[model samples]
Target: MEPIIIDGTAKTPTVKFDSTTGVMEIKGRSIPENSIEFYKPMVDWLDEYAKSSKDQTVVNVQLEYFNTSSSKCILDVFKKLEAINKGGSKVLINWYYEEDDEDMLEAGEDYESIIRVPFKMIEIVE
Candidate 1:
């Protein structure tokens, strides 16, 4: 399947979804003007990827900041991954945050509590 590679803008996050390695990485800020527009393609890509997914799918999310709209979009992405996990394949979400970013860590923990997939919170040291 074709991968989703979106370079980050001032208001958006960098998205790199590679089906070959089964690693979907999203980094940088995610406060886009239109969260649905910004995230729909990636969500659609996941729909396609789900058909022939790898045995293990890992999602790495590293965001410094994101607005409420973006947060919903992010949850949509995670929900898709949760479905994949429920389908018998393993799906892991790695939530990366700076060591001092308590809000980011809490956000990840929030998702972990709501989502079905396993999440690994990684603290990035500057």
Candidate 2:
């Protein structure tokens, strides 16, 4: 599978999904006008990747901010990973949040609770 790389804009995040390494990353702000449209391809790619996933897949999410719509899309991505994990592959999520951002930390925690995949809350020192 080809890698999926999308550059970040003021209203979107930078997404890098490396099929070879099984390391997917999403960073920056996500407040796109159409969140579903922005994330559909990503969710589809994850679905495809799940078929030939690595023994251990790591997803790194470092979002500075995201709107409510984007939050649902983000959860969709995690749900895909959860399905992959349930299929016997080891999946790990590294959720990065700024040290002073309580909301971001809580968001990570919420995702950790909702998704079956294991999550590591990484506190970034701004």
Candidate 3:
């Protein structure tokens, strides 16, 4: 599968899905007007990837600040990964947050608890 690349804008985050290694990464701020519009294709791509995916899949989520709508979209993305894990594939999520951002860390923790996939939280100093 080809990579899904979306450049970051003022209101939306950047997305990079590398199908070769099954390392999907999303970064930057997310506050899109229509959350579905920004995440629909991504969700679709993940679904397709899960069907023909490798044994190990890693999703690296590195978002600075995302709105409530984007939060829901992120959860949807995780759900897709959960489905992949249920299919006998090992899945890991690396949620990176800024060192000073407690909210982001807590958000990651929340996702970690809710998701069945193995999740690692990392604090980056920037």
Candidate 4:
């Protein structure tokens, strides 16, 4: 399967979904005007990847900020990964937040509580 790569913009996050390495990452801001439109492809790709994914999949999420819609879309992405995990592959989520950003840390914790996949909270020094 081909990889999914989207460049980040002022109002969107950079997305790198590598089918070869089983390493997916979304970084930067996520405040797109159309959150669903921006994230639909990613969710779709995850669905496809669920069929023959690697033994272990690693997801990295590092967001500076995101809107409410983007937050829901992000959850959708996680849900897809959860499904993949349920199917047998090991899925690990690495949630990165700046040490001083309590809000981001809380966001990661929130997602961790909602999703079944194991999550590692990584504190990044600024």
What does candidate 4 score in Cα RMSD to the true structure? 0.7
Q: Provide the lDDT at 93 for model 1.
A: 96
In order, candidate lDDTs are 0.94, 0.94, 0.91, 0.95
What does the lDDT come to for candidate 4?
Answer: 0.95
Stretches of candidate 1 exceeding 4 Å from the true structure: none
Q: For residues 13-120, could you state the per-residue lDDT of candidate 2 as single tens digits?
A: 999999899999999999987899999998999999989899999999999999999999999999999999988579999999999999999999988888888999
The TM-score of candidate 1 is 0.97
**Candidate 4 on 1-126: residue-level lDDT in tens?**
999999999999999999999999999999988899999999999999998999999999999999998999999999999999999689999999998999999999999999999999999996
* TM-scores for every candidate against the unseen true structure: 0.97, 0.97, 0.95, 0.98
TM-score of candidate 3 against the unseen true structure: 0.95
Model 1 clash pairs are none
Point out the higher-scoring one by TM-score: 3 or 4: 4
**Which whole-number lDDT from 0 to 100 does residue 36 have in model 2?**
100
Using lDDT, give the best candidate's number: 4
Encode model 1's per-residue lDDT on 1-126: one tens digit a residue.
899999998899999999999999999999977799999998999999989899999999999999999999999999999998988569999999999999999999999999999999999998
Evaluated at residue 4, the lDDT of candidate 4 is 96
lDDT of residue 28 for candidate 4: 98
